[model samples]
Target: MDFTPGPQGQFPGAEAAPRSAPPNFIPEAPQMESRTFGAPGRPGVPVSPQFGFVRPGQIRRCIHRYTFIWLVNGNSFWFYPTFVGNQFVQGFRWRRNRWEFERINLRRILFFRCF
Candidate 1:
């Protein structure tokens, strides 16, 4: 009546040796998207042939949020750089406010650069 395998019970096709967890391996939670294309190198460095399924403007907003999260919490939900979420949107807005203040001081610089 017992279902537990015993020392002599053979499990067909089972490995002979009891499996050991890999030293450097960690189990990852299941995710919605299995893959993503992302910008290379560092932020603000500008990537050519920009990657991701989202639009460029939206990508910028998401990237801005991702960097803010990394700076504030040392972690981010930006597992895939292209995917945007509610939290990322909020973070982006917070960052955008600070960026707005900084931009105000550089209005002349921006004007000159554009011209």
Candidate 2:
């Protein structure tokens, strides 16, 4: 009873007669239930910790800095760049989760400017 197609594009073991559907073909609308807020069964969980920041208005700004500085596992490190008088200089490098001063000329990198 295998209906595998051959290289000539013809079914090898398919039947010539057509197939018919069932007698009871009743199609009904899908049963959908409305969900209410603060439902116990819902899988919604709090995104951030509630104890840290009080209200939504208290949150100021979110910063995402990505600097491609490879140390051990090829990960970018973030270094704060500040303008000093007429010239810009690299302030500090965030190494070991702490700020460390580094002598880097910010004037050379004219494209990167953070206000």
Candidate 3:
């Protein structure tokens, strides 16, 4: 038996469901500039690498989670999932050289400019 629900089954008292736009409804456009930081041939900055990864001064979202992360200089910043509205209130940073992970509070960071 098919487990899928029909339109009326999903939403009661609603009319026939509206058709969805085509998957490629919006045309693709070429990127005007590189997303990587610094000029080409730089030591730290390199051209765009594979997905799900990034270099220094670059940010990327996790493939399977709502978390976002970035690396600047030698420090790494992470924004974990939070229920406190749309803002990220909890996270931690890893200091590459110091080998320490510090908790981050977005409220304090925004108010005091701590990070």
TM-score of 3: 0.21
lDDT of 2 by residue, 23-95 (tens): 1222221222343222232233222221121121221111112222222122334444321222223344556
The TM-scores of all predictions, comma-separated, are 0.17, 0.25, 0.21
lDDT of 2: 0.29
**Candidate 3 on 1-110: residue-level lDDT in tens?**
23244665532112321132112222222123356444323433433333212221122122112233333233323332211222123222223322122333232221
Model 1 stretches with alpha carbons more than 4 Å out: 1-32, 42-56, 59-115
lDDT of 3: 0.27
Residue range 1-115, candidate 1, lDDT tens digits:
2324456753221223212211222223223244433323222321223222223343344332222122211222211122233222111111312221111111111000000
* Decoy 1 TM-score against native: 0.17
If the candidates were sorted by their TM-score against the true structure, best first, what order would they fall in?
A: 2, 3, 1
Write out the backbone clash pairs for model 1.
Answer: none
**For candidate 1, which ten residues in a row score worst on lDDT?**
106-115
